[model samples]
Target: MAETVANHILARLREWGVEQVFAYPGDGINGLVAAFGESDNQPRFVQSRHEEMSAFEAVGYAKFSGQVGVCMATSGPGAIHLLNGLYDAKLDHVPVVAVVGQTARSAMGGSYQQEVDLQSLFKDVASEYLVEVNVPEQLPNALDRAIRTALVRRAPTALIIPADLQEEEYSPPEHVFKQVPSSPPAELRSTAVPPEAEIARAAEVLNAGTKVAILVGQGARGAAEEVRQVAEVTGAGVAKALLGKDVLADDLPYVTGSIGLLGTRPSYELMRDCDTLLIVGSSFPYTQFLPDFGQARAVQIDLDPGLIGMRYPTEVNLLGDTRGTLAALLPRLTRKDDRSWRETVEKNVTRWWETVEHQAMLDAKPVNPMRIVWELSQRIPENAIVTSDSGSAANWYARDLRIRGDIRGSLSGNLATMGPGVPYAIGAKFAHPDRPVVALVGDGAMQMNGMAELLTISRYYRLWSDPRCVICVFHNNDLNQVTWELRAMGGEPKFEESQALPEVSYADFAAGIGLDAVTVDHPDQLGPAWERALNADRPAVLDVRCDPEVPPIPPHATWEQMKATAQSVLKGDPNAWHLMVQGAKTKAQELRRGR
Candidate 1:
């Protein structure tokens, strides 16, 4: 006998090493949900408040653990709601396997309630997709391929299982799916690296320049130490894209800052003024911010040949994985002549620290958002997984928190999605419960998709797991800021205009569901409250109060601008919104600075 479509789906997930699959019970997915309730080896199913939250939690798992995160949702609204989370995982290079239930096979194409072109809807965004229609044979192949592609491409994949297929009866024994690796390119192993002369020439130019900077992108993940070696040899500072934050640890003395919109001034100015830029791993998107031929020369190293000249004009193109390229470059490169370059960058950093960072500590009244992230950075174990959502909280943590070991969080570079923090933390903590997890979420994002997962963690606490593995988020009450800011770019911005729940409390809400909760209104109150919540032996939440008027980040920012990130200066035809945005990026109080 064969397994049912739902059973086959469960088996396929197990083969991918998924211990749990996040989902919400629904009509379209009821069969699979029932299968989960019955099976012994079934991935521990986490019933989420909403489907989008499920997807996001899975994204968290995949990104932090480097394993595929599995999520499931029913057809119609549930499946549609997952698009944002799916796109986030895709952009962030998390290997996610999402199973979306559709109407019965007969009703899938037409004449079904809530039927939509899900495959077409998600095709461009998902790395791979399959409309699973059978139990034993088709599901085994389809889901296996989906999982494998997600891992290989380092992006999200999907399996759309129709209701008929899921409910169909079949054999008893399950065949666990196994994906055989396809043949590597013929030249994969034999391809020798380029000559040492190329590296030497690039090194010579790098060493010769008094001011040089390294640019790392998403491509820098595993080559941190190597990049540091290159930085040490070059005596140049480092700047990274948002996605590349973890490529090098935040405290590396050579780091200047991150670059792009909401990027710091030093990186923009340094890259703009510096004589040479070393492009590693990343093919960063914001080419307008990149220095052209007038001020800087670029030497780009990437494994993808197509990416060589796609962004910035390249002075030297080294084609290979960053690790291989850096390893080869290190041996041939000479120690840089400009030993004072790091000192200059460090000086600027120190000035930034005193003027921006220190003043944040002085905020005594409504606890400054900066102080919260900074304090969290100091309080949490360095290696603890720190995830942040969009808007103010995200901007604060990204710029303020110095992320430490085996750490992974959300950074949807250009998209800047909301509701990422809690779900990502859920996934991160679930995958690595031994690792402490903390998420700093805004009231806005918390309301969107994050609040739904409160019970998910609560259930885990019931098992005596490390309750500290998940941080509680009761974000500031301005719960629709991300949607409002995003409206200017795309849709209507009316969420702030009319909030449905004026008196709703996420902490209370979590507690109502048999979880523990805490609340804090002032910024100063946040640190202690969170510390207590984190130290609690079970799942818990802390509601941190923030002023509704405080902006998430400034569009026009300097170094302090990075954490309270700023956008590019607006057009001179400035509007009130732009003026307000500019003001938000400015420091409220500056400490007296001494060089």
Candidate 2:
């Protein structure tokens, strides 16, 4: 049987188990669609309002499923539009494959319609790039290798398929394709970190301090047990970066809380007062949060050797597996109760937690961002899977929510694309259907990417992002209030142009797409809407008309951000003393809520 290049490409994608593809149309890419129309093997084609959003939808799909997501675009402006999503996927290590239809094959590198170097445009973002020059053999080889690199390396990849190749009739080689291997957990090395002499010196310096603090990042996640062990042996209080939220349980007695701009009182006070700070598995981007090494000694250990001492000045740098290093450190430490230090920090932790929890349950006429997150925190089963799309909504969920249970889970579009909230929720529910899945998506974000992706697959499609999925979108009409703050600075607020408050009734759109959707305009209806969504076996969308008046606080804010804090007003301005008093009240509030 003869197959066009487009058909062959579709065949490869089907082999990859890709049933959902998000994209926008272009002249050069028409043949690709035609090829799908021509065959029984048509992959699910979704039309995204914007190209960047499509890429984001892809990453969201990938992050939850741990499978490579596929997206497509035509040359020139269409291809350029994909950069934002591509970068997001690249940074977060989500596997993706973009099928970008390029300038006609004859144009090559010379002047031609929509001719820009797709290779160079995507070079920094993707781990692998392949331009299909051969319609038959080379194209298939490129497709296979690109998928392999993306799935195996856990990075976004690209293939620039020439427009002409899509229309070329060719025969595919006869060979059954096997999916790629799953990434295995890393094996621990048999050696210690920083050598015996360095360890001895580090231990001596750390032991000299009356107040010792620990900061654990995501890189510390795998070594959680080892971290607890070392903290017990060393008597160090613990905190984490926002990305490391789940690295340890929030209620771990020694666990102070999250640190950095979004950090709490327990972490901030300890950091300010500690004579020694130990950083593990985290290269928290903000250097301001780190204490001065001249006053307090700092020691860091990480899996990536290059990260040590790069973010902050360090008295000691230990390079190796974090788990292994901690394992080694556990035995060398002498435990002494720093009653004064622990008692003081623990009080602050308690007081500060209370205030945050109070704001979470605040009842305003319009729904406060806190209420939305708090309600979500309450209704969602402890084991429910949570997926986040990029924006303030995602940051808020990561920061304020308290997740419990051994089987609890959350995935972020660490790639930073919006509009993935709904579709990713769909994918996550499919991945862990027995466990309820809730996707928190902003209204602005849901419009850009997920609207069509959800609307496109209305009926039974078990494979592509699972049609059985259900998600709740916190509908906000404006673009990211967080990025708007960033743009207020001199920096270019990239991707802001994609924001659209579509007038279309999202619930009606969902209905049109064959899924149950209900919009909650008032707070009274919100709870019932969510309950109904949870009860349904088929995929459903609960659209809560979120208050655009309330702005959001991101996980990592800057000194600049502190000035802009308007969502809630405490007893005093956020000066150091004010923070201590105010933060204490916050902690007390959280403690009461937990009870």
Candidate 3:
């Protein structure tokens, strides 16, 4: 029998360094599924219980490995199931290639069973690229374009392949019965560098300012040393966006934690006071948290020109690779010897951390979630990969989990979707089998997606000799973030029942799934629980009972926020008073310290 288009596609996937593709089976994609069955385990297809999880797993794979993630689904609903996770990849600006099956070519126009116009459905989400392979000859071209577009644009791309075309005998433009090559031409990749004039202009703007602040984002991941040097020579303090949290050690005198609602006090102060802002590869959407336009002159560095001034108007825009632009601009800058501004920022960072340490150590009946993040920050392996779900768990992780050198991590990014944590860990573990993986998820998000993906981990987990992956669920039994948001907005938690979750025994569930599990209720057991989770030879779940009332305080609370919180307390909400007191004690104390 002649080779089929599906076989050719699978062969190409393997050659492109894709060892696995997250997928779900359906009648529409039987040809592709059968092709996988004959590939001798090359480009192994990982069967996820849900198509959404498969896409999320693929996103997780790309996030940790810096490679294009691949995911496939059958026609119609299976294709639609991928939209959520694909949106996660699109918003996060990660590379993902989604291969979606379509009904037979003959059935497409007639609207046969499971036939849907996937290209139209995926258009907005796959803004970077989307194509259909209706002809057998279009397979190689579609695959090449989709992969290249995803890699170059750093966004999700999609290919809709009809069942009839997929099963047809593969025939290339130039080949008869020959084996087709899988990988595309190597020269299709290039790195952009900003012009010398642009770099010089950015440096001039930096040199003109006495008090400079640098805002770093995910784009600055590999340029850590250059960023440090730039901060040092320019006497600038660095504040990171949540996605860029791991770029520098939190202990650095000038390094501030995440900026925004989950930001550190030092970061808030940095943005509020800087005379000039040097933004590196961050499109931080919250302009209110940024310095006022006229308050600070700005220079932004980004690979994409469209994003340069979209966040904040800039005096100079440098378009190029982050590391290269910074390296070239360093020499053009006039070094600042004045330590006064740097010292003030460093002092603020110190005080902010001191407050953080206090909160992390605060004794509560139920374990404080921040303490879990703090302990994990201390115990995280040098080569670990960490992920967090959306909600209070993400907020706590953003605030307390300090990133160490060479450690990799991911969150939902611009999409901010929940339930990707466990899938991310599974993907990371597959990418770096020797390294440890950890995921932090909330009770709400855990029930949404973590439970199913945990089973996914259990199936293929034995592939690794040292399968050390920890899934830490903050089992607070409430939609804590939403509850706190209501209070922050001056609404009583009277509707709290709507946001409440049914009690779940995640530890018991994990034990039933063939993994060691532990439940940490008291603060004292927190450290020991983490220790056990980290060392387990199999995947482990640490279900920690954390306080539902502790608010994830904003970096700087406005007068209006204080009023809203006060009103909530006056409304007879059980936990409102405690939350208000916590905020007053921590953020209010920071304000007093500044005074």
Candidate 4:
């Protein structure tokens, strides 16, 4: 029964149904690397170019696969490099288990080489569950606990095993082997649905108001049909938080695209004027987007009881699974025949699409970013998974890229971190190799993380059955989102010179890596470039030189925002006048529409 600690660990992962692991090797974990290489029936280890990207790939795996993603790295700086990607999973509430190698047990407290306080480093991000396997026997119990805790808590967990312990002989206990035999118990899965009485109370609260709006988030991904039913019965217009963007079809008549900063006009209107708010599985933190206090009666449904009223005041808190709660509540509600509210919102959606289309068709000196996103949207194959880096490019993707309900994608979510889109696309392609994967990245984000990670894509491109991945790099030569934020904060663009980036040919870089690549500096070449990349036999990058000066106007702007933008124009900002006019027109139109 004797076995190496690494073997026991691999066996546990196999038992947990983990088929793949993302990792990067270093000298500190030579023992684990060798053991994994020699073991049979072990998880397929996909080595990434960087430890940071390996962890990001893990985050992406969890996002697309809906399973506990497994990733490993050697100790010291290797473990530290995992913090950002682990934090991405933490903020998004995804399950991920990080197995980190540590210095030898004999070297403890001796200031050994590459030694770091991993527990302290991971305390805040992986606080839900973290432990070190101090001895060989503890491996069985620790692995079981860490894996199950990560699943149950829906958060990242870390298991640090000293290299010596990893190489030591061990025998797993009989009972310990049965501890994590399969998926989490059915009780844990079904316990999240609220009691029938709670569902009834929520239904009553929802039925009391004439104008109701439903805002959903990532928690409602599985309850799309149920959400539609609830919205139909209550005459509610549906609005999605960014994470929930793929949940409901964007083309649905009653569905409003995203809410808050990068939201649609209909969504802003829906939240601004609704008499009742029925939030399902969403904790949209922007108070400005929600109806003011006392303006709407609220009912919130969430699996986490602690977050029920954290965003808005709730009259009835339905603590349950979104699908279960909505199913139980639907029968108790009366259907509304009047379609005025929904029709009005739909009108706004129609006008908004027109505005979006017009903007996408806009001609400029440097190519408009929206034009590229629009063309990509039109050409993106069904069920393709797409990701957008955080920046102005995200603004375009959030507003323009029409999401087909079957398509799966994600951003940095609550972390709102940059440099994850390309890594996310890499992970998604690995998880579902048959599906096409694309990343839309701003110039700054492309250089920040996408540049180095492109090498990882090149390394693994030929290994997969179908390597259909494309990175659409926005070569706008500026941190466009930050520049706009600076203007909105009443600062002149002249003083924010640090936001500008030196131009680089991402297409050339990709081509040099043996990828099929093209650069588009004119609108006429955009469609052909996208077509070329989409049909490439290998990974590709469409380096698009986009206009950095075009303003990404928010769906709704405050008076102070308007004033700040006006001030920036007076301060001699190049694009401020254009932005000011755009904002003024939107504000004036909303006022006329009775928003």
Write model 2 residue lDDT over 465-530, tens digit each, in one string. Answer: 433355567666656555445432323332434543555577877877778788877767766776
Positional deviation of residue 457's Cα in model 4 after best superposition, in angstroms: 1.0
Residue 271 miss distance in model 1 (angstroms) = 2.0
Best by lDDT: 3
Candidates ranked, most accurate by TM-score first: 3, 4, 1, 2
What are the candidates' C-alpha RMSDs? 5.7, 7.1, 2.4, 2.8
For every model in order, what is the number of clashing pairs? Answer: 17, 18, 0, 0
Q: Over the stretch 210-229, how does candidate 4's per-residue lDDT look in tens digits? A: 88999999889889999999
Which segments of model 1 are wrong by more than 4 Å? 108-110, 127-136, 167-208, 303-308, 362-365, 405-407, 469-476, 479-504, 514-516, 548-595
Q: Which stretches of candidate 4 lie over 4 Å from their true place?
A: 174-188, 494-497, 572-595
Question: Least lDDT summed over 10 consecutive residues: which range in candidate 4?
Answer: 179-188
Question: What's the lDDT for residue 438 in model 4?
Answer: 90
Residue 193 CA displacement from its true place in model 3, Å? 2.0
Runs of candidate 3 exceeding 4 Å displacement: 174-183, 187-189, 588-595
Q: Poorest 10 consecutive residues of model 1 by lDDT?
A: 181-190
lDDT string, candidate 3, 1-595, tens digits: 7999999999888767889999999987889998998888679889888999999999999988889999999999999999999999989899999999998887778968887878789999998889888777776877987888898899999998888788899876555554333446353444577888888788888999999999999989878899999999989999999889888888788998899998888999999999999999899999999998799989998988778889988999888889888889888888898889999999988888777777777765488788889899888887888999989988888888887777877799899988788888877877888888999999898899899888998898988666998999998889888777887875565366678799989999999999989999998898888889898889899999988876788887788876776777788777766665656565555565565
RMSD of 2: 7.1
Compared with the true structure, all predictions reach lDDT values of 0.68, 0.66, 0.86, 0.83
Model 1 per-residue lDDT tens digits across residues 426-469:
88778778767777777666666666677677667554356675
Return whichever of 2 and 4 wins on TM-score. Answer: 4
Model 2 worst lDDT run, 10 consecutive residues: 179-188
